[model samples]
Target: MATAREEPQTTSRARGDGLYYGWVVAWTSFGVLTITYGVQFSFGVFLPSIARDLDVSRTQAAAAYSVYVLVYSIMSSVSGALTDRRGPRLVLAAGGVLFGIGYALTGAAQSTWQLIVALGLIAGLGMSAAFVPCNATVVRWFAHKRGRALSVSTSGGSFAAVVVPFLAGWLVERTSWRVLYLGCAVMLLVGLLVASRLLVGRPEDIGLTLEDELGRRGAAQPRPATADDGAGATGAGAEVSLTPRQAARTTSFWVLVSIFLCTWLVVFLPLVHLPPFAEDLGIGATVAASLVSAVGIGGLVGRTLTGGFSDRVGRTVSLAAVLGVQVVAFLVFAVSDSLWTLYPAAVGFGFGYGGTTTVFPALVADLFGRAHAGALTGLVFAGAGSAAAVGPFVAAWMYDLTGSYRAAFVLSAVVNGMGLVLVVVLRATTPAHPGGRAAEPSPLRGTGQLAPGRRR
Candidate 1:
């Protein structure tokens, strides 16, 4: 019995013979995101079918997704707190169960209310539980490499974007939308089983340390005070332990919330309406669905590239660049007259949208230490969720009013531009370190290095 117990301890502490266990966490997070977001994003593929079959207006149909976003966003803070307090295993397990059940039931809904309950409330809550925890967990596993780690983990959503829409489009061609939900349920079940076995809450929980640049275990170096440190001793750049309440009191925290809210307002507009908009343009269902897949493809590239890019360029610079790309993409989407133009537009928007997911969390970690990462990230997401809740519905309402998506698409571009402005202003205001300190010079200055007890 003692040998058996000791064996488990040895395995936990093994560190994969010099391979950081954090990579395992990153990949496992990737899997969970792939499954969760695959189902979440597939809603677009289902939108046209559901609206046609149920005989509901586009605004009503889009409301289901709005509800889903609302529920998901509202629960984010609660779930983040749970993940922080109890670790991610239980939260993720619950999420998988809810996700599977919610999709399965959504498949059976006979009315709009039933659809809302199944997809919006249940599935949204499940996604809330699963999504934030994965990002939070992966962030805790790496210090200097947090941006890359986040990119790798979140790329799962991009992967899902590529695969799920195409798969759903194809499947819906052969099977009913109901059948698609059943398929989502099965996928979630299988993904959860695999994730359960592999997910680790943190490196310390498994007796490992954060990896340094050389991929060896090393202690974090102290942050040397810089010239700006004396001027802004209480700014965001200083290294100080902060409770969630304390962090909430700072100007940076509220600025992040505003930025998240505005960014996602634009981000989710297309996510919910893109497929339907294509269909309205006389694009075939399969082809329209492929547009979403295009976004996913662009997203996959963006997610992967931005992680490393942000690590090199400052997060604010990288964020502003992607947001600018989104503005251009949305403008193209707003005015495009043909499917050819639409396809390129989708790629641009997807790239920017995917990059936002990567940069925002890293920005949060930069502004707030990882100690309350789960809660802090969740707070940011709460704003995003709130934006998502209204953004699509507003677009749908615009469509209802104008009989075209042109106005909605224009609105998306405008909001993205606003978000870009906010980011630029925020970068100007935030200190490089917590407590208003100037950043120290280091070999990995832009590659996401941080002081001990803090993370970028």
Candidate 2:
């Protein structure tokens, strides 16, 4: 195996086309997320219409959401292992196809059980493959701009949320809920086709090297986190190029995983609650539908702004900000009952949630290095996915008991607070490097500043 520390024989600078190539890779990652996570995020838009059309109870229809999350969470490991083995192209393309097929099949689903199998299981699995791999690939392609790149690409999920819900809602108004699914199927097909054309399998496949991707043309550079910086997530025998296995032995890996899981738990609970919460407040159906789109818009704004900010301020700062915003948003959510109050809550929550997606992948790469990035991120995301699976049900159970969403809202606040606490703990405990081992300080430590003799 080619060790991460061994510079690639070829560099993107040698081709003088690395910048343009990096954008291509970033766009590809965006496309992959658009179909998979985008569709997944839009599920709430179809909830009321799907339930009315199918004659299922809201609680029963909610099962589809539960199943989708369950499968998505459960399959994350498999997706990561596969991404590391096959590269992202096949994995993302397959996800696109599976998602497209799942939506198409969902249009024909005559029973709740069939919908679960089609949209929940098949589509969820597809998204799992698409999202984790695309995230890992972005880690490979951009080093300097990793935060911004990941923020931009992962923001696609929020973009889809912003767009797909409104589109689906309009389609439902114009035709039927089934047709909405058919439209999604067609869109997913197109997204998959685009991903197929654009997604290069690896950096070597695209004729680039990792260094060309370390930061932006004029951005401040942060040093890679090292094992000794209280970041021994990469264990012994590790160097500049570290892999997931190398990082697994360290305390940072689990801490990162724990922190993210807390955030995701908060993230998914609201996804399930948003549409109905608006409906319960006596908001107009169309307006409520539009609110679903607002989350996406907030996410787009959040991801774009936060990702770029992380490049300048550092990943930890951005992460902390996102968690803080989430805390405030959930606090608003717990008290709000009208559109006037809830609209702002939706925007804040979506923005914070969306930004979290953008920051997470870059943070993972910063903490662990790129050698085993795909596998490590996969494992970390798997924990987040598992949290997502349980979160909605927890919300539902709370609602079932209270006959009101207040308890659920309070619970979301608590979960977000937990994430904030972890963020504090993370900063306090993690070293800038790993293993207390000093060969040369990791280039990724502190910030990506050059040594005294090195050129700017």
Top TM-score prediction, candidate number: 1
Displacement of residue 2 (Cα, Å) in model 2 is 26
Clashes of each: 10, 30
Name the Cα RMSD for model 2: 6.2
Each prediction's TM-score versus the true structure? 0.89, 0.85
Clashing residue pairs, backbone N/CA/C < 3 A, model 1: 235-435, 235-436, 236-433, 236-434, 237-433, 237-434, 238-433, 238-434, 238-435, 238-436
lDDT of candidates 1 onward, in order: 0.77, 0.70
Question: Taking the tens digit of each residue's C-alpha lDDT, what string does model 2 give over 73-191?
Answer: 76877777777787776776777788788889888888899989998888887777777777777777765567777876787788877777777666666787787778778887777
Q: Candidate 1's residue-wise lDDT over 269-344, tens digit each?
A: 7777888888888888888888888899999999999988877656778888888999999999989878889999
Q: Give the number of the best model, judged by lDDT.
A: 1
Q: What's the lDDT for residue 37 in model 2?
A: 63
